[model samples]
Every structure is written in structure tokens, then in C-alpha cells.
Target: MPDELHRIAAIRDPFEQLRQATARITAAQEEVTELARLRRRVIEGLKDQGLSYADIAQQAGLSRGRIHQIRQQGPRPEGAFFGVGSVTIATPLKREAIRARPVVAVEDVAGAQRLGDLARSLRLEPTFETIPVGGQIDLNRPNLVVICGPRISTAVAETLAQDQRFQFERAEDGPWTLVDRESGQVYRSGQDETAPRNWDVAYLGRLPRPDRNGSVVIFTGIHPQGSLGVVQLLCNNLAEVYSATNGEDFSVLVGTEYDPDSQEPLSVEILTPYHLLGDLS
Candidate 1:
């Protein structure tokens, strides 16, 4: 009986120890969370009043260095773990970072005569010069000028300056067409043709050419709406046009909005450009 009581006591002691440990952990977590919440409320309140980090730190009875460290450090307060500002959870279709990419030039107007032959070979009609002023460029012209690339530069200035008509000041939507290597189709947005593209001459670059991977082209235009849908459509259509074409993955970013207050630039982003690649197969 005494041995049985000892065994029971031993089991009860371990359980009691476990309960104590759990209670301690829970208390510590609760304390840390409460402290973090209080600190955040203080910081937020100060921020709401337009207080600088330095100023808020001064008021918090802590050094600016300490407060700043706390604000920027990892392992945020447990309370904030699920609260707002805890994690920077990104949307699945996040846009690419706004920045510039480099590009190589494919043609100068001197080579414009070769465009029709190239377009015909590609089994596609090329849009020559897009006069940015009134109407679309005449694609049938013998001198069809096309730039392929992905970045910004003096080359863009040259393209727009060649025809004042090509310099678009404002725009809305587009049935804009672009060729895709994966999908050989020239996808067009159903938006109005006059809508401005989200382009920055300083940051424009080139997209690689489909036929000769060795060759590339630069272009000047941005779809006011993101190019993802249109690019995907183009990719799918290309698969139909060319039997040998395999479904390849690619991304296209389009659509931008300028802020009214700060005039800051905002754009829609689609991270998985290749999501629809295998759907056709």
C-alpha cells in the first residue's frame, strides 16, 4: 500500500511540476504581450500626434536607441503576433518592386525596312510607330520601328521625340497588344486604345525576342491596367498558334494609380505569372 501511494505521489508530483511550468510560461507570455501592447499604444498615440520617433522615445522614459531597437527588432510581442503590424504578410499576387531594369536596343529607324520581313517571318503583323498624340501608329508602314527591352533611358527620349504624336501625356485603358514567347498570340486589352500606359521613359527596358533568344527589343508603354491578364492571354494564344510551343511561365505587371495626396505611384502586381502555364496542356 505504501509503495502504491509513493508511485501515485511520484506521478502527481510530475504532473504538478508540469502544471507549474505551464503556468509560468503562460504568465511570462501574458506579461510580454501586455507590455508590448502598452508600448505600441503609446508609440501609436505619439505617431498619431505627428511625433517623431526621437520625440516619442524621449517621452517613453527610454532612450531613442532602445525604443528604436524595440520597434525594429524581431520576435515581436506575442500580443502583436496576431495583431496588426505584426507581420508583413504579403498578398499572393504581390507586384514586383518598383524599379528600373536594363535593356538592349534591337533596331534604329535605319533598319525599319527589315521590320515587315521580320513580322511576316514571325507570322505576326507588327505595329510600326505609335504616334502618342492622336491615333495609333500605322502598322503597315514599310518603316516599322519597334523597340524591345525592359528598362529606362535616353533611347526612350529618342523614340518619343521622333514623333511628338508618340508622346502620350495622359491615358486611361487599352486594347494594347504585346507578343509573348510562351503564347505566340498578340494579346490585347479591351480597354480604350487612347488610355495611357504605365511607362516611365527613365525606367523603361527591353523584353527578350521570342524567335532568336539571342535578340532582344525595347518598348515604350505601360498598360494602365497590369499586363498579367493580357500577357497570360497572349501566352495561351501563342500555344495555339505554334504547335511546337510549350507552355512557358512568365510575368507581366500592369495598372498603376497616382496618389492624390502625395502623388505617389501605386501599381497592381501579380507574382505568379506562370500559374496558368500548364492549364492549356
Candidate 2:
């Protein structure tokens, strides 16, 4: 309300006042809509926990019929796993060995497109941006999905370092890999070994933003194929993923087995369970 419009009587221009009023009303309506969706989501959770409509109504002081109606209205709660309203998907621009200029990879574009389509299907607006050569993006923004690996983004690397469950590290001469800090298990892309295969592993997680006001979804892999596989996995199993993570700050490792010729994923698996980091600072 910092820029909220004052009384029309105090305004000298009625024309500008009308525009201000309209904008304020629209913003209020949007806030109301999101609040209603959140309430509905809570009711749905109560029901999911084996509570009857009557029980939920009693706890909330609403009628059973109204509770049931609320359950059917608004967007699905799982959709919040991505974002509310609009979402921004950021891919990285990398300097390949042969290319003189850094460029967005074809595989990254494909992955971003799939993620954008997923956002659209959930009734949310989707926008795409390519992280510039340095991979320095605004991490304070809300509803952001970053698909750049740590090797590519210092900002993203700092954010990932806060999550203690999994460590993304690379040796002096080896490929970038993921390590289980607790068990000392290491995950590496199949294409990196001396005898390469058609599979890759990736990291998927909702980590706290730099400001700690909210969270950002981070998905990255050792290679472009690995990130693409994360999208393919989410496109099919977002619900299960949502259920496990439940809108919390968490990280998980995923593996994508792909065809060698086309680099298309043949199968996707959750390499580790959701590692919650809600207590992290």
C-alpha cells in the first residue's frame, strides 16, 4: 500500500484517479483469489489426512457443504509446487569448446519449453530468460526456476551451498558430480566416464532465496541432457514429487537413462528421497 491511491476528493485529476482506483481494485482481487486458493488447499489437506468434510467444517467453523464446495473450487494445491500466477524459467548460456561466443544450448531450450508448457497447463503464466555468460541472475525474485549448473552460476552455487543434504562438487580433472554428504555416495553422468553410457544424473530442489523471504526451484545437471531429463521427469510425476516435498525447502537427486543416439530419456528415477532443509538458515 506504499503507493496506494488516496481519496478522490484530494485528487486534482479525476481521469488519473480512475486509473489508480482500477489498478488497486485489480490488485486486491488477485490477492483475494490467491488467499481463497490457499484456504482451499488447507481444506484439501485436511481431507487428505482422513478428516471428513464435517470434521473440517467444524474445525474451520464452516458448513460441510461449503467445505466440499471449496474443495472443488480454485486451482489444485499441487500447482503451487511450481508457482502462483506467473513463473520465470531461467536457462544458462555457456561457452562451448568450439563456439567463439557463449550461447544457450538446444537441450536447455527444450527443457525450458517443457517446463513452460507445464506452467501453462497449470493456469500460470510462463516467461523464459537465458542467464547471460556469467550466469548472474536476480535471485531475490519470486517464482523463479533456475536450470543452470553450479559450474555455470556463482549465484546459484552460493544458494545450493546452503542446503546440506547433497553436495554438488567437481574434482580437478573430473566431471561435475553430486555427492551425498551423509553417506559419501557420489553421482556422476554416464557420459563422463572413459567408457561412456547414455545416462545422466541431476539435482532438483526448492531452496531458500537469498533474501529468505520465499523459495526458488533449482534444477540442474552435469550436462544439458541431465537437466532435460529432470524436466521430463517432472512433466510426468509432478504430483508425486509435490506430495513428497509438500511445498517445503528440499532437494533430491534424480537420474535419467536416455538413448545414446538421440539423447532422449528412456527412463527417469528419483535417485534419493526428498531431503528437507526447512531448518537450514
Candidate 3:
């Protein structure tokens, strides 16, 4: 901190000094926000371990009142599963049937909006973006969540290809499916059946970003219902899901049995075990 201040002080131009100071403050603001979240989590975690506020305060050199306040404040730590401070949700634009113009699917919009609401509840800012019709997208961004399928987005497909454990592709038999490499089990959406049922399978994972600085959260399925069902799963099992991965880069196939009329998931199940990325063992 002193070194940065000294650097700012050494600046000859006052305007440049002011600009550097401003940039430093902006960077500090993000750090401060993250630190507060960490403080709150630790304070509450101690309480869960049966430590009294006074006990924690004594150990941490803080007052009991401060401990109480910290426990109730700051962003929810579990929200970090989706992102840190802000998350940009990127859905794909599908071409209109007749007009052949790019358009966002209604179900995708609902899923994106619902996820946005979930992000807000976690005290994270949410914004929306759309992958264009040809599937070209820049996957090098911080805190990005993509809700597009591999068939629609080649970029997403390429990202998924980095995972060696499973593959999403169509077999000669017909339907596009998520195939488990080790077990060789094929997971196809029930909607693909001859006697179509009200079920779908979705893929959810935290994939490595192209830049490799961090990762991006991705969820997609054979159909839009798969994505929608996964969103509901997220809304209900966020904490559990976050605990399962701990924000690691991994992938899982989700099976969802939903209502035929409303397309609401009645049951959601994790089909395959989590295939953790960067785990050679």
C-alpha cells in the first residue's frame, strides 16, 4: 500500500496523480467488498461451530457488537459458485422459423431472467448478453455464465471438448446425447423418444476460460427445456451444488423429468458423477 502511494506521490503531473489515486481506490473497492464477504462468512461459520459472539470477538480482536453486525452483512459466500461480484449471462440467438432473423428463445429468456434474480438474491449484479446465430463468441471474460448448447454454439462446443470424460454429440442412431466416456452410457432427452415423454437432460459445468485466468459457468441441454430445468435446479439447489463443486472446473449431466404442459421440472437428478477438470488422478 505504501509503495503504491509512493508511486502516486512521485508522479510529476497532478492530473496523473489524481488518476492513479482514483484507479487505486476503484481497485480497493472491489477488494474491500470481497474482504467483507469473507469476514461475514468466517464470523457466521464460527457461530455455527457453537462459538458465542463474545468468544469469536475475543479471538478476532473485535467487539461482540461488530461480530453480530458482520454475521448479518456482506454478500452470501455461496454466490461465488456463480460469480464473485457480477455475472454476465450469455444466451444464444436462434433464427426465426419463417423470418430467418436472429431471435432469443422465450424459454431461454425466462431461464436467464430467473438466474438473474437468483444472482441478485446472492447480492451479485447480473447482466445479459446473447451469442449470435453463427455461434461465434468471446469466451474470455470474467464471471460469465453461458446458457447455450453445443449444437448452437461452436465456441461452447469447443470449450466442452476440453473435457475428456464426456462428450455431447449425435450418434448414427439419431438423437444428440451426452455420452459418458468411462461408463459408455448414453443420456438422451426423453423428448427425443418415439413416444415423447416430459423429460430432458442438461449439461452443467464450470469450464476453463480460454484465457485460463478463471472459469465460466455453462449449462445447456438437447432442448431449451433442459436449460430451463437446470435453472430451476439452480434456484433450488444452489448451496448444495456449490458445495459439491466448491467452484472447481467440472461437468455433470442433469436429468430432468418435467411437466409436459408447463415444462416445469418435477424431478431433477445428477446422471453422471462430476468429471473434475485438471484432475489427472
Candidate 4:
């Protein structure tokens, strides 16, 4: 009886082993949660220093919603346990931060005015700048939004010229056509070629900046009306437009149909799904 008891004590119990493993897992999970909290604190610090939420999300490999969630939570209390020990993380001083408000460059006063209204509606507070057609631009700014077609906004034209995914072309007295550079597919506004012009094609894309510090959003069209339509779409259907891009660097073409008499947009339709640019990050 004594020998049997000794053997039972020496044998490993699966249930006991599972209990010990579970305890270790719980400890590891706690540590991970602590680290995540610290990470959110650091993100908030960077945001306070003027880094845009989109830029932070790109750098951290996280979604903008996640970044917003962290910011919305506000600051953590002091003496919070950051790891195994209760360490009160100190907030760092503000660094020299880049301007968070983007610059919205347009070709004409009308386009600039429309863009300004759209920005205000979206709560973007972007600076509006009017540049001459075919003029040279440095594009040194961290963030920019260009409006109008290639004939007017040279920046938008030049950017599209360099991009191999899509091309915008217009012939003498013909409708503007957006060509898929890879697939050779062509898209134009309106169904009938002979029908009175009541629709326009617009291009919207987020591309990597030359400095690689941030991104540039291009909203241009083959015609002036097209540019206005793009802005209207942005202001009216921001969530739907943004959802298509999903906060990534992408290009999309949209067609807007308007009443010829009133010149008011009747409907806006997405011409294509978001086409992602490769590895802009």
C-alpha cells in the first residue's frame, strides 16, 4: 500500500499540467494587454505632435479607426501597470511637427471655391491654393489635394502621366475617356455618343508623395463640371467613397450625370472598384 501511493504521487497528472499551462497563458495575455495600452499612449503622443491619423496608422500598421479609438479614449491615469511593474509612463514633449492640415490646389476660382466648401463640409480645414495650368510644381508639401483636369491643374496631369494604372485622354470635340492602362479598357461618361452632354468622368486617387513623407489626393476630371461633380460626391457620399478606398492608396473613376438645363447632378456612379497602388508605404 505504501509503494502504490508513492507511484501515484510520482506520476504526472494531465489535469494539473493543464492548469499550470493555463496560468502561464493568462500571465502572458496580461502582459500583452499592458503592452497594447502603452502602445496606444505612444500613438496619442505622436498624434498630439501633429502627425495625421492616417500617417500614424500607416507607420504603426494599424487601421485609422484603431488610432481614433486610442485618441478617443484620452490619456491614461498615472501609476498604471505598463508591464510586470507599475511604471507611470511620462508624456514626451512635443516635437517640431509638420502641418496636419492638407493643401487643396485647384485650377480655377470656381474649383477652388467648390473644394473649399467641400473641405469645410468634411471638416478638413485645408488650405486652398490656385496654380496655373502647365506650371511647374515642387510638390514638397506633406499632404495635398489637387482639383481640376490635366489641362488646368498641371500637378494632377503630371501625376497621372507617371502612373501606369490609368490614363485620361480627350480628343478634339470628343468626350473624355479614362483608359485602363493595363487592361486596355476604356470608360467614358454617358451611353450614347450623340446624346447631349449631361455626364462627366472624374478621377480620384491617393498617391505617394515625391518626398515619401505623406500622400497626395488627386480629384480631377476631363472637364470643369467633372471636377465639381467629384467634390460634390466627396461631400455627399464621403463614407461610401472612403469605404471603396478603405483608407489605402488607391485610384477610382466615377461618372456623374447632371441635368443639362439646371446643370445639377442627378446621380453619381462609381465606374470602377478601387484599384490599389502597389506598396506605396
Candidate 5:
């Protein structure tokens, strides 16, 4: 049986093959980690060169909070995965009240409350802004988060309109829809007059600055329930979401089914992978 034994020995072992594959995966992970480190160092160097946070964020296509985090390199605070520096909640106001005291809609207040709580949990400050439809917006914050939909916040709508990755569509006499610009896939909310109430879709993404510096995180939904779901997802599963993005800028489209009476989400689904694209600069 020596010939048989020799033949068996000549064949490759399955365990060895698995071990080699595992080694390759580990090596690749290490390489990614190293590259991240190098990128952080470059950002730090830029900060040292007297560049403002906005300028650094603009150059690196990163959030101001992310740059600040890299610069500090300190222990991470609990629930701070998004690396946000400040949060802004945009609500609708009358055209004549554009420069006057702003009035906030009930739905907008609910959304703002959820996001404000999330910001406080992450030890970040929150700001509430009232903008009239189609009004001017200040988009120069270093790390900013916007909470509004196309119907209320013209700034958010305009930003999404200019972006080729996604579109927020609200046609008369139909349900609100979120369209994927590249794939032409549509996610709709059950808000039509004829349709029974059902699920809603939300758009969440960290996009690059459009006019000025820093990054913008947009939280918008087809309806109030959808906005609530987006906030819930971020608050409850931020770490998981952050891991999915590998700490990179990403956008997500989510579908959430909620209870008709309670207005609570029954289930939530991440409709797409963390999409990597910046706003049109």
C-alpha cells in the first residue's frame, strides 16, 4: 500500500487550502487598516497646516466630526459612531416668516426631538433651524446633520435634486417615492388617497459638501413615520451601520413598516448596501 499512501500524500489537503484562504483574508484586512491609518495621518497633517475644519473636511470628503475624531485619537464615547459634531433640525415656516420667528410643524417637531435626543446621547450639540420653502440655507458647518424632507426643507430637497445617486419624488395625487438614480429602482410610501396605509421609505446618507466645506448627514422620509424609523435605526443600530460602512461616507435607503394605530415601526429593512458617493461638488 506504499503506492496508495504516496498518492494520498501528493494530493492537496483541504485544511491547508482553508488556512491559506484565511491568511489571505487577514492580510487584506490588515492592508485596509493600514490605509485608513495613513489617511488619518494625512488629514492630521492638513489640520496642522492651518486649514480650518471646513477646509479639511472639504478636501478629504469627510465629516468635520470625523476629522476632529482623528485629530483627538482619544477614547471613543459611547454611541458616537457617526462622529457627528453638531446636529441641525430643519422645519418649515411661512414665506413671510423667513426672517422672523419660525413655526414648526408637529411632524417636524417629532423628528427633531428624536434626532436631538440622539445627538445628546452622542455628546454632540443640536440646533433647530426654521427655513421657509425654497429659502436660502447656510451649508458651511464643519459637521452638520439635517433632519427634514423635500416638502419642508428646500435645502435638503435641493441637495438631493442635484445628486445623481438618489431622487426624492412627490407627485400630486400619488405616493411619495425615493428613486435610485443609477438603477431606476423606486421605493414608495403608502400615502396615496386610494391605497391602504402601509410601509414608508427613508433616506439616510453622509454626503460631501455641495457649496462650502464639511459633510452633511441627511435624514428624510416620505412621511413622519418614516422619519421616525430613520431616527430609530440610527439611534439603535449605529454601531452596526458604522461597521457596514467601514467608517466611510455612505448613503442608505431603508424601508420600514409601522403600526397604523401606534405609529411604531414593526419592522425595518435596509434596502441597499452602504452606497459610496458624494454630493455634486
Candidate 6:
């Protein structure tokens, strides 16, 4: 029995070691809490600067919820505000109209109405044309022409790219940014190099509506190239358009062509009068 006990003594007591490790872990946890407290101050400052939760989380290598929790807490540690993340905001580029001439936009009825509303909203008047072949409108003419189709044909996009009037660059992997001939600024949105599909609303950078003269010209298309969720959220919040409708509109356009034969009736209840008059005034 004594020899057996001596053999067992050779092995260390793992349970005792585990207790020490646990105590060390508790100390480390306390240190982590201290660090988190310190981080809270800097996070509060960032929140005040319009930095989003996701942006802050990415920079901090922590979860957004954790940063939000830190922000929700009132007070922070003394040295917490020292380390901060980058503070850069993406400012959207603006372009001016090239020529004060009649503009043409190719789109469906719903798109037409929305574009019309946008024109009325901006006070910029332009011609809406359906025929693509007529030389009545010069394709090469440097005017504020807002294209509101579901999707622009690849052929047209290629042609537009060849035109020297607009400096076109494939902005990111999807959207093409086009700078108007008159305005050096660039406007960005995704372009579908395929068939025309669903209609959506957008502000053509160049066209300043006459009524809303000198203001941005917003137009609608059957299908627009962008993250639907972002656009839908904007519509829901600003236009008072329901998210479900936006979702339905987006889903119908996904992986298929949108039917232009029928126009969806927009509920007047969804329309929110956004006054850009103050800006123009």
C-alpha cells in the first residue's frame, strides 16, 4: 500500500492547480473590466460625432452591442478617452447641369410620376421621351438627361462610356459614377448592364428641376442598381413609404425582369411632403 501511495504522489494535484488558475482568471477578468471601463469614454465621444455602432465596433475589434452598452453607461474611467478610431466621413460628390436644354428620361408610368414629382420638387423641367430612335433628342448632346428605366441596356451604357461629355468610371464593383460635362462632380449608383426591370427613384446629379430650380433632380426607374435595404429604409423613413411595399418591389426585380405594362398605384398616405424649398431659398 505504501509503494502504491508513493507512485500516486509522483502525479501533481491538477485540482489544486485549477483553483490557482481560476483565481488568476478572476484577476484577469477584473483587469478586462477595468479596460472596458477605460474604453467607454472614448466610445461616448465617438457616438457624439455621428459614428455608427458598427463603425465603432469594427475599429475597436469588439461587438457593436458591447460598444452600445458602453455608450449607454453614464460614466467612464479617467484615461478612457485617449485611444480613438479614425474619423473620416464619406461626403457625396455633387455635379452641376451641363446645358440648359430639354432633358429626356426613359421610364415607366410610375417612374414617370415619381420623376415628375422629383422635378416638381426640384423645380427642374425636362422632356420625358419614350422613343429611343428619334434624333429629336441628340444622344451626344450635353444636357441633364435622367435615365429612369428599370435597367439600362449594356449597349447604351457602352455608348455612354464612349461619350466624352461624361467622365464615367466604374465606382466600386457595381455602380458607375458619371461626372456631367458642365459639373466636374461625380454621382454614383449601381447600373445593370442587362434588361430593363423594376422602377426606382433617384436624383440625376445634373438636372436641376425648374420649380425646385437649382436643386437636385430626383427621378424614378423601374429597376435601380443599389442595396434595396438601404434605399427602402430611406423611403420608409423619409417618404413614409412602407418597408413591406419596398421589399415587395425589390423582391419582384430580383433575378427577373420587371413588368412595365402595369404601374403600381402609390398610396397618397405614403407620400410625405419633404420641403427642399428651405434649401433652395
Compared with the true structure, all predictions reach lDDT values of 0.34, 0.85, 0.85, 0.60, 0.68, 0.36
- In model 6, where do residues sit more than 4 Å from their true spots? 1-107, 133-137, 146-155, 160-281
Model 3, runs deviating above 4 Å: 1-29, 44-54, 279-281
Residue by residue across 1-281, what tens digits does model 6's lDDT show? 56534444454787765665576566565466556655665786687699999999999899998888876662333211111111111111112257544334222333444534443332233344442422222233322333332133332333333324334555565654444444455544323435433433232122223333332222232233222222233323422222233211111111112233533322112112221222222
TM-score of each: 0.24, 0.85, 0.86, 0.55, 0.62, 0.23
* Candidate with the greatest TM-score versus the true structure: 3
How do the residues 1-281 of candidate 2 rate in per-residue lDDT, one tens digit apiece? 24354464366788987887787776776577677778888887888899999999998899999999888876666678877777899998888778568888888999999989898776577999989988789989889999987888999999999988798888567678899898889998898877888889999989999998889999988887888899998899987888888789999999999887787889999999789897666
lDDT score for residue 19 of model 3: 96
User: What ordering of candidates by TM-score runs from best to worst?
Assistant: 3, 2, 5, 4, 1, 6
lDDT of 3 by residue, 188-260 (tens): 8888887888889889999888777788888997888888888988999887787678778888898888888
Every model's Cα RMSD, please?
A: 23.7, 3.2, 3.0, 19.7, 21.2, 24.0
Off by over 4 Å in 1: 1-12, 74-281
* Candidate 5 lDDT, 95-210, residue by residue in tens: 43566555655555776787778776655567887766565666556556676666765566666665567778755656678888778887778665366666888898876656
User: Candidate 5: which stretches are off by over 4 Å?
Assistant: 1-85, 94-103, 133-135, 170-173, 278-280
Q: Tens digit of lDDT per residue, candidate 1, span 1-281?
A: 56634444466578776776676666566566556655654565566688888897777778887776666552222222112221111101112345433222221232232433333332233344422322222222221223322222333334333221122332224333444434443433333334543321211112222322321122233432222222222223332322122213222323334333432234432211321222211
Angstrom error of the Cα, residue 93, model 2: value is 1.4
Q: Kindly indicate the candidate among 1 and 2 with the higher TM-score.
A: 2
How close to the true structure is residue 210 of candidate 4, measured as C-alpha lDDT? 70
